[model samples]
Target chain A: MKKEQMTPTPLVQAIGLGSAKAGFSHWWLQRLTAIFLIPLGLWFVFSLAGVPDYSAATIQAWLRSGLNAFWLGLFAVTALLHARLGIEVVVEDYVHTRWLEVLIKTLLSLAMASAIALAVFSILSLVRGA
Target chain B: MSQPQTSSRPLSPHLQVYKPQITSTLSILHRLTGLWLAVAAAVLVLWLYGLAFDASLFQALTGFFSGLFGKVLLFSWVLAFNYHLCNGIRHLFWDAGKGFELPKVYRSGYLVLAASLILSVLVWLGSL
Candidate 1:
C-alpha cells in the first residue's frame, strides 16, 4: 500500500466533443504577439512623440535609422497579426449568424492581409529610400 | 440516432440577470477595448501608406488627426491602449496562477484601473 501510494498513477487521457480547431495554437500565438508588441508598441509611441514635427521628411529620416525601422516594422507586423487573431475570436463568440460570421471574417482577413503587405512594403521603402 | 425529447440541460441566465461587479465590468471592458484597439491598429497601419507612396493621403490623415474629432478618437485610443495593456499584464499574472484569492483579485483590479489612468495621462502629456 505504501509503495503504491508512493508511485504515481498515470493520468487519465481526456476526450471532448469540442470543435476540431487549433484552439491552443490560436491562443498561444495571440499571447506571443501580445508579448512581442509591448516593447515594440511602447517604442513607437515614444518615438513619434519625440519627433520635432509631423513632416514626412522628418518621419522618413526617423525611419532611416536602423533600430527605428526595425522596431517600427516589427510593431506593424506583430500588431496586425494580433489584431487579426483578436477580432477572429470576437466574431466567433458574438456573431452567431453563420453566413455573417463567415463573410465578415473573410473580408477582415483580406483587409488585414493587404494591410500587412502594405506595411512591410512601406517600411522597406522608407528605410532603403532614406 | 435520436436526441432527448425534452431539453434537460440547464441554460445560464443572460448577463442582464446579474448585478454588475468589478470583475464582470472589467472583463467586458477588456474585450471592448481590445476590439476597439484592433480597429485603431488597422487604421494606423493603413496610415503607414502615407509614408511610402501617398503623400497627399498622409497629409490628409495628419490633418484629420489634428482635428477635434481625431483628438477625441486619439484620446479614447490612448485610454483603451493603456487599459488593455495594464489589464493584459494582470491577465498574464493570473495565467501564471497567482492572485487568485478574492481580496487579491479586487486589489489587482483597482490597481489596473489606476495604472491605466496614469499611463494614459502620461502619454497624452508626453505627446502634447
Candidate 2:
C-alpha cells in the first residue's frame, strides 16, 4: 500500500465527533454576572433596607430617582441573565430527554425574557413619574 | 468503554444506601437555593409591576410581605440567597483550579454555612 493509504485516521476524526462548545460560554458568563451580582445584590439589599416605607408612592418615588432607577435597571437585567444561565446549567445536567430539554429551555428563556421586559418597563414607568 | 451486562444489581452507592456528607449536601443545597432564587426574582418582578401600576394592589402585596408568614418566608429566602452566594464564590474558586483539597473543601463548606447564617441574621435584624 502507498504510504498515504497506510495512515490510519484518528478515531475522533473518523467518527466525526466534535465539540459542542456549550459549557464554556455559559460557565464564563455565569461567573462574570455572578461577580457583578455580588456588589449589586448587596446594594439592592441595603437600598431596600433604607426604604422607610413600602407604600406605592414611596416606592415609586424611590425608584423614580435617577440613580436608583439606573441601578435597579442594571440589577434587574444582570440578575435575570445570571439566573437564566444558572438554571440552564441545571436543566442541561438533569433533563436527559432531548425534546423535554429543549421544551424546558425554551420555556425558561421565554419566562426570563418576559421578566426582564416587565421589570424594565416598570422601572421606566417609575422613572417617568407615572 | 464497553456496555456492561444489563443485570439486576445494586448500582454503585445509590441514594437510598448513601450516607450524606456535607460536601454533597451543600452541593445539593446550592442547586435548590438557586432554583428558589429564580422564583423569588419572579416575585420581585411582580412587586415592581404592582408598584408601577396599582396602589391598592401594591399595598396588599406589601402587607402580605409584612405579615408573619411573609416574614418567615422572606427570612428563609434571605438565608437561601446568602448561602447560595457564599457557595457560589467557593465554586468559582474551584473553577479556577483551587480549593480542591479535601480538608480545604470541607473547611470552606462550613465557612459558607456559618457565614450565610450569620449574614442572614444580620440582614434580617438590619431590616427590622
Candidate 3:
C-alpha cells in the first residue's frame, strides 16, 4: 500500500464529530438537586399550609425551631441551585449568541446566589430571634 | 465542518409548524414553571427578610399575600411548583433510561398534570 493510503484517517475527518461533553455535569447536578428538593419541598409546603396565621410572630416561631430552620435552609439552597441549572438549560437552548448567553447565565447565577444567601440569612435571623 | 449560512439554513420545527403534543407541551411548561419558580424563590426570600427584619414590614407583606390578587398568584405558584416537581420526577425516569415508550410518556405527562392540579387544590383548601 502507498504511504498516504496506509496512514489512518483523522478521527474528525472520518467521524465529523466535536466535543459535546460539557453539559453532563450540569444535567446531573440538576437531577441531584431536584431529588433533594422533592421531600424538602413537600414538607415545607405542607408545613406552610398548616400554619394558621400569616403573622410574623407565627412564621418566626416556626423558623426558630431548629429542624424547621435547617430544612428551610436546605430547601432554599437546593431549590435555587436547581432553578439556576434549569434556567441555564433554557437559556442555552434559546439564546444563540455566545455573548448574550454568557451575559444571561452570569445574571442568573448572581441572582440565584443572592436569593440563596438572603434566604439563609433570613432563616438564621429568625432562628436567633433577631 | 463548515457552519451553515444563517440566512439560507432551514430552521428546526417549532410552535408554528409542529402540532402540539402532550410531551412537547409538558416540556415547555416545565421550563416555564421552572422560570416562575425562580421568581417565586426570590419573592420567598424577600418575605423571609421582611419577617426577620421588621414586624410592620412582615405584616404588610403578609397582608398583600393574603389579598385576592396575592391569593391568585399563590395558587398559580402552587400549581406550577407541583407540576414542575412531578415533571422533574418524570425526567429523572427518562434520565435513568426508562419510560421512553410513547404510551408511557403520554401517560406520565397526564399523570403529572392531574397530580399537580389535585395537590395544588388540596394545599389551597388546607390553607383556607
Candidate 1 residue-wise lDDT, B51-73, digit = tens: 68888889898999889999899
TM-score of each: 0.85, 0.87, 0.88
Clashing pairs in 3: none
TM-score of chain B of each: 0.89, 0.88, 0.89
Fill in the DockQ of model 3: 0.56
Ranked by lDDT, top first: 2, 3, 1
| Higher-lDDT candidate of 1 and 2 | 2
Residue-wise C-alpha lDDT for candidate 2, range A5-117, written one tens digit per residue: 76443453436445546767887899999999988887887678678778777787888776999998999999999999989999988886778999999999999999999
Position A30, candidate 1: lDDT: 90
Two-chain complex of model 2, DockQ on C-alpha atoms against the true structure: 0.40
Model 3 alpha-carbon drift over 4 Å, by segment: A1-22, B1-7, B54-56
lDDT of 1 at B58: 92
Q: A1-130 in candidate 3: lDDT tens per residue?
A: 7876764434535364655466678877888999999999999888898887887778777877669899989998898898899889889888988889999999988888888888888888788876
Interface RMSD of 2: 4.1
lDDT of 1 by residue, A22-127 (tens): 8989998999998887788777766776787778888888888768888887898898898999899999988877789999999999998998898989888877
Number of the candidate with higher lDDT, 2 or 3: 2
